[model samples]
Target: MVSIVQTGVANRASVIAAFERCGVEATRAATAGDIEAAPFLVLPGVGSFGAGMEALRAAGLVDALRVRIEAGGPTLAICLGMQLLCASSEESPGVEGLGVIDAMVEALSQPARPRFGWNRVVPEFGCEVITEGFAYYANSFGVCERPAGWACAMSALEAPFVGAMRRGAVVACQFHPELSGPWGLKLLQRWMAMGVAAC
Candidate 1:
């Protein structure tokens, strides 16, 4: 079963529906015990960096997430959820991220700070989850400093940002898989397949 960390900021119902549409059963996990009871975890987020982290802390999920991911638990973070995995973000200075991955989230360098549309992403460094296709994106901040080969996909929009990154069992995406149509669903399916294998 997939445990979705309930940050109370993301579209939790929509994400769960997406998973169900793909024939995957997912549960919303709010407490540490709920999080620990699942085989795999999905962290979804929206809004500013500070608010997201605050919600995670308020829900007392930070340490539980850290422990799970560090223990090699399969995880997928989406949008602001992915940004929260970084060490820090320029979106809200002085706010610390979960720091599971050594990277920083910064404002997109594109003309429009918040890019809103379908953008094409190409897989880099032989990433298994990232495939070349159009994925929906609506974000003001993204991981600009990709840790070399960890970048699963690269999007040229917003001055070539890290569209997706993966290390071991932890995977993150700046795009919303729940809203990216078929490509997004396929990506989630790939994630579930990987999660099943890891189990």
Candidate 2:
């Protein structure tokens, strides 16, 4: 089973559906306790940084997530969820992030804004969870600097950005693997298999 954090600003239905397609049972984590006890958790977001943080705070999940990630919990954070792992985002000045990663989310240098559709992700090192493939992305802001101690993958809108980063059992993706078609489904399957093996 996969417990998905209910941030209220996430693409919940699609995420759940994706997990279902993977033949994994996916449920919403309605409380912090649910998050704490989940074997495999997913933090997905599709909105502004401040709004996502506000929803997680309102749901009383901020501290729970911090503890989970700090302890190297099996987690997959996507898009805005990936940004929330940082210390802060330029998208929301004065708003603090989860601080799991010592980096900041910044606006993309490209003028096109929200670089939508598919882009290729090239892993910087040998990564078990990330591979070189075209993944779907829909964001205007991204982390430009790769955090130390994490395996990173890169993608470019105009300039390069951290497309995915993995450390221990936690994997964060700036692109939507769930929406990336067959390549993405395979990624999700691999992630789920890894979680099962960890158990």
The digit string of per-residue lDDT tens for model 2 on 66-95 reads 999988888999999999999999899999
What's the lDDT for residue 32 in model 2? 91
Instruction: Name the best candidate (by lDDT).
Output: 2
What lDDT is reached at residue 110 by model 2?
Answer: 44
In angstroms, how far off is 153's CA in candidate 2? Answer: 1.0
Per-residue lDDT, model 2, residue 73, is: 85
Q: Write candidate 1's Cα lDDT for 1-199 as tens digits.
A: 6788888658898899889989889887889887777777899988889999999999898898888877767889999999998899988899989988788887786443777989998887657677899989989888876765365788876378888987766789999989999899999988878777877
Overall lDDT per candidate, in order of appearance: 0.84, 0.89
- On a 0 to 1 TM-score scale, where does candidate 2 land against the true structure? 0.96
Candidate 1: C-alpha lDDT: 0.84
